[model samples]
Each structure stands twice: as C-alpha cells, then as structure tokens.
Target: MMMPAAPETDAVRLREAMTESLKTSGALDDPAWRAAVAAVPRHRFVPGFYLPAQEPDEHGLTVWEPVTADADYGRWLAAAYSDRTLITQFDEQEPDWAAPRVRHGGTPTSSATLPSLVLRMWADAGIAEGHAVLEIGTGSGYSTALACERLGSAGITSLDADPKRLETAATALHSCGYTPTLAVADGWYGYWPEAHFDRVVAVCSFRAVPPALIAQTRPGGKILLTLSGWMYGYARVLLTVSGDGTAEGTLLPGTVSFMSARSHAAPAFGNPAHWVAGLPEKARPVRHGPERITAATAEAFHLRYLAQCAVPDAQLTTFEDTVVLVDVVSGSAASLTPRGPGWDVREAGPVRLWERIEGVLDAFDASGRPGPGRFRLCVRGDEQFLSHPRLPSLPLPSVGYGRASTTGPSASRRMPGSGR
Candidate 1:
C-alpha cells in the first residue's frame, strides 16, 4: 500500500494563500520578497488584535473588542491571514490579550500595516542583499521579521518610541527565531548609534522628513516614508540623501497613510464641541467662482496636499456641501459653501483663510493640474521646500517662508499658523 499523504498545516496553508494573493494582486513582484513573506509567521507576531464590535452594548456605543488566537483559534487565524491591517493597540495602550472583553471608543494608535502595503514599500526601497536597513516604528515586529528574513538579523535595526511596544516586539521577534537590534527611542531622532545605514524605512508618517534621518543615512541611500499632516492627507515619498546632507525626491503615485510619528503627532483637539463652540468672531461674505479644486475628485489628492503644504496646522472637514477649514493655532477659520454659480466665503481671525485657499486652488489649477508625482521635495538643513516644474517653488510652513507671500487679498501679511 502507498503511504498516506501528510496533512497540511494551517499556518503553512495560510501563508501560501497570502503569498499567492499578493502575487496575483501585483503587490509581491520579487520571488525573494515572496519567500520572505511566506517564511515569516505573521500570526506569531499578532497574538491578539482589536476588531470593531459587531453590535453596540446596552449603552449604545460602538467599541473595539480584543480577539486572541488562544480564545478562538480558527477565527483569529483567519483574520491573521487576511490581507488587511490589524489594530494591535488603542490610544497607545496595549490590549489585555488574555481577557475576552471589549474596550470602548479609542483611536487606533498602532497596527500591523496591511501586508501588501508593507511589501510594496519594501519593493520601493529596493533593498539589496547585505544592505544595512534601519526600520522606524517596529510595531508588532511583522515588518521587522520580513526585513530580517531578507537582509539577515545582523543587517537590520528596528526602533520605536514606545518602550512597552518595543518590549512586546522583542518577545514576538525572538519567538520567530530572529533577534535584530531593537531600540526604544523616538524615530524622529533616527537611532544615531546605527548611523550611515544603507536604507531607512519609516513605517510611521510625519509632517516633514526628520533631519536626523538624512544625517544617519549614507549618501545615495534612500529613505521611504509617508508624509502626513493635520489635514489627514498623506503621500508616500522615496527620497535619496545627497552628499551635502540634503535629500530630494518626488512623491510616489499611490496613497499611503500611517500614524504620525509619536514626537510629531499634533496636540489633541479634545471634544468636537470645543472646536466649534463659537461662531466666527467676525464674518464677511466674499464672491468667488465655484471651487475648481475639491477633496472629492481624483485630483483632490494633490489639491489637499497642496492645501496642507500651504496651511500647515489647518484642520479640514467636509459636510454634504460645505468645506470647513480651521487653524487652531492662529484662531483662523473659514467656511466655503456653494452659492449658485459662485461660492460664499466666510472668514474669521487675523488670517485671510478663505482667500489663501482660493489662491492655492487657483495656483494648482493654473499649473496644468499636476498630480502628486509631479511635485518634488528638496530638504536642506532644517528647511524643506516643495517645487513643481510648472509652478513656482513653495516652501513648507515648517521652514520659514522662502518666497514672497502670495496668500490672499492681504498678500503682504504673514500667513498665520506656521508650524507642524
């Protein structure tokens, strides 16, 4: 009699499925990367994660419930193998994995990013064998494990700002038979001890490229990260460090949003009521044409980015027919609403917020409507400026304004709210 075929393990089957899906989806192009994904056991890294509660409790509030592999192996394994992000922490607090309970109302603080996104960013980095890679934001250590498999443990160093997160990641990474250098430090500072890295990959987003990252990366080395701002718009960018400590690069084609780097996260806005408590202290109606750039269309991605670049600390919100812009630091607010063939503009505080927005929208429209890819970023020392071939250079507010003001009716006045 022929020997019976061996049984297939769940982990192996799930891994194969995920790898094949990534390949079919065009996310995993390289065989080596596919192998790395297959070899690393992601389920081992995320023992527990938060899922949206199915139904609100008697209190009528939606919440996130913790699910663990031990509590429901089949369900947890299914989720682990799915091609989606898994929230591992809420408000920077670790979930009690052992307890089968729900936590009420908190924003996601950390997560194991979607597998396809992680692989795509790695592909963008184009890491070579034996390349020294420094990974910022080592959440759950899944990406770290993938890096270790591709570059070997000796070539990888992972850092995070949370000591608790680092401790947990260390345990999880060790369980997978890999031990890369793990550090608890603010990623904004870029671990200086491991300077001159061949590549730097930041899993977290920030308002601007950290100067220390450029200092630590070797000339010609690439840094891949997502640029995000208070408006919640994000663009993935790949920058190459120059010999003079300056870095220049273009925004990538796709959209990728990550949690803001811990040190760069904006201060809490607290209650929504507090934000919209009072009417505009002063309001005057102005006439303008219907918005040529909006947050609803495909081109809106670049428009929103331009807006954020123009107004650094402005918060943008959209209702059915109105766009609300507010800069808490400057106490400036604007409401742009549709009015027949034109727009009704209301402004408050010292800054001409509505006029500034109109100027940006008009500039963007006049520039042949270039996409994010057409924009280039140049960073020298502490200042960063964005430029497009068709448009004039615009300095990011994080750095002092480099060119004369072109904001609005008060073109000579300094733009308000000028910090990350």
Candidate 2:
C-alpha cells in the first residue's frame, strides 16, 4: 500500500497546477509573474473561505458557509489554490473557522481577490523589478506575496483598514518568506507616512481617485484601480500621476470590479418603499415612456450607467410594473408607472430624478449612443469626471453631485464576476 504524501508536498503540487492553469488561461503572460505565481504558495494565504448556501437563512441576505483548514486541510488547501475570490470577511467579521459556521445578511467587507485578477492588475500597473509598489487592500496577502516574489519584500508597502486582516496577511506573508510592509489604515487614504511609490495598485474600487494617491506617487507613477459608481459600473483605469498633482487615464477594456471602499461606498438608504410612499403626480406629460428607461435591452444597460452620471445619489429599485428611484439623502424620489402612451411620472423632494435621467438618456441617444469604452477620466485634486470625444464630461461619485444610495444597481442586472 502507498503512504499518503505530506501536506507540504500536496501544497507544492497544487500550487504548480494552479500556476499552469493561470498561464494557460493567459492571466500569467509575463514570465516573471508566472515565476512569482509558481514560487509563492497561495494556500498559505487563504486558510479557509466562505461559500454561500443555496437558500438564504432567516435574513433575506444569502447565508454563507465556512470551509476551514483545521477541519479539513485537504479540501481547504485545494480550494485556496483555485482561481476564485475567497470571501474572507462578512461585515468585518471573519468566519469562525474553528468549525462549520455561517454568516447571513452581511456584506463581504473584504476578500482574497481572485488570482487571475491579482495577476491582471499587476500587469496593468506594469509592476516591475526594482520598482517600489504600494498595494491597497491587503486581505490574505496573496497578491503581496506574489509581489514579494517579483520585487522582493523590501519593495512592497501594503495597507488595509482592518488590523486583523493586516495581521493575518503579515503572518501568511512571513510563512512564504515575505515580510513586506503591512500597515493598518484606511486604503482610501493611502499609506500616509510613505511617499513616492512607483506604482499604486488597489484591489478595491473607488468612487473617485483619492487625491492623496496622486500626491504620494512619483511624478510618472501609475495608479491602478477600478472606478465604480452608485450604479455599480466598473471601469478599471490606469492613471499616471503628474508633477502638477493631476492624473488622467483611459479605461481598461475589460469590466473589472471590487467592493467599494467604505468611504466611497453608497450611503445607507433603507427601504425603497419609504421614499416612494407619497409623491405627487407630474403636471406635464413626458416625451418618452419609462419602458425605454426600464428596458432589458442593451440600450437600457448603457442607460443605467448614463443615469449614474446624471443622478449619483439615487438608488434604483423595480417592481412588477413600476420602477422607482429614491435619493434618501436628498429626500427625492421618482416613481414611474404606465400610462396610455407615456409613463406617469411622480416626484418628491429637492431634485427631479426622472427628468435628470431623461435628459441624460436623451443626450446619450443624441451622441450616437457611445459605449463606455470610449470614455476617459481626468483627475485634478479632489474631483474626477468622465469624458468622451462626443459626450459631456460628467462628475464621478466623489464630488457628491447628489446624494444617492444603492440597494443595488438594478433589480434585474446581476453584479459582475468580482462578487463584491
């Protein structure tokens, strides 16, 4: 009879397999990235993770079950080496991996972002040998370990708001022979004491590029992060910081998303019904039907993003027949119901949500319906705006154009692959 292999042997085998898989998939095109992937053990970083159950628990939110290494090392190691975003924390609470445990009705505050994603972002940022890197969001430290393999531990500085996560990442990095700088601070602010990093890569999405990032980065350095919105639109951008404290860049082709930074996240707005409760009917008829705006067509998908530009503060919710836009902070709400030829629109509060969305949609159509890919972003100090050759430059989430929240981007649309 054959004896079982040691855990270390299995870990090496699995890590090799995962690296090969990433290379085959084109995620690890650079040999240096591949070597880093091959060298650093991913299983060391993610000891366990949470997977959602098919049925939600008492709370309406999905309940996630924990898989732990102490309970089953074989399974945990296999999964850790896989190419998936492992849910590490739910509302700041790491799952009780002591046994099979579950968390319900809580948001994924942090995670070990997918391996391909880590490699992809590193490639996009052009992280290289001898270049110092500042990584935002050090969850499990898997990405940081890969960076260590590429640039050595001394060249990397990574931070997270959660001290526990940083502690865990530090332990994991040490085990893999990496002891990079791991600090506990809000990633949105960047590492304050450190300055002049060659590349700043954020695993989390931001509503606007933090001005602190531009100030800290070397004049020609790059800031790689996803620019998300209240509508949950993801635009991964690579910004090159300038000496004048201004940064500008074009959107990367792919749709990449991460959980919004706590500061940039949509404000908490409870119950859509509360905002739509009592709104007066519109006095004038509108030109277009709400059907066009609430549509399932490609145009509607694009329209959702366009609406995000116009009304940064309104959260959208849909019912069987009607769609509602509620801006809890502004005390503004728009209710759309069917009428004979057009939609019956109602409004309450300071801003007219429907009229704004209509105006944006009209402009989008008139601009020949440009896809989001053609857009460019310019960041100067605090404000950031989206620009295209034809369309107008619209303010992004940071400036607080208006106060809106997100129950989600839309009831019908699924959040992208990032899971955050």
- Local distance difference test, each candidate: 0.76, 0.76
lDDT (10s digit) by residue, model 1, range 21-108: 9999998888899899989989878888977878876776668777776666777777788899999988887777767577877778
Candidate no. 2 TM-score:
0.86
> Which runs in model 2 stand beyond 4 Å of their true positions?
1-5, 55-60, 282-303, 319-321, 337-344, 398-420
Cα TM-score per model: 0.86, 0.86
lDDT per residue (tens digit) for residues 1-420 in model 2: 122457678888898999999999999889988999898888778777887778987756788778776666666787888899889888777665655576776788889888999988899899888887889888889998898889888888887777777777887777767767777766665665555689999998877777767767889999998877666655678898888888989877655679988767777777766666777754456656666645766556555666777788887777557777788668888888777767778887899988887887777788888765677789976578888877778887664322222111211111111110
Candidate 1 Cα misplacement greater than 4 A, ranges: 1-8, 53-62, 270-297, 318-323, 337-343, 399-420
Shift of residue 255 alpha carbon in model 1, Å: 1.5
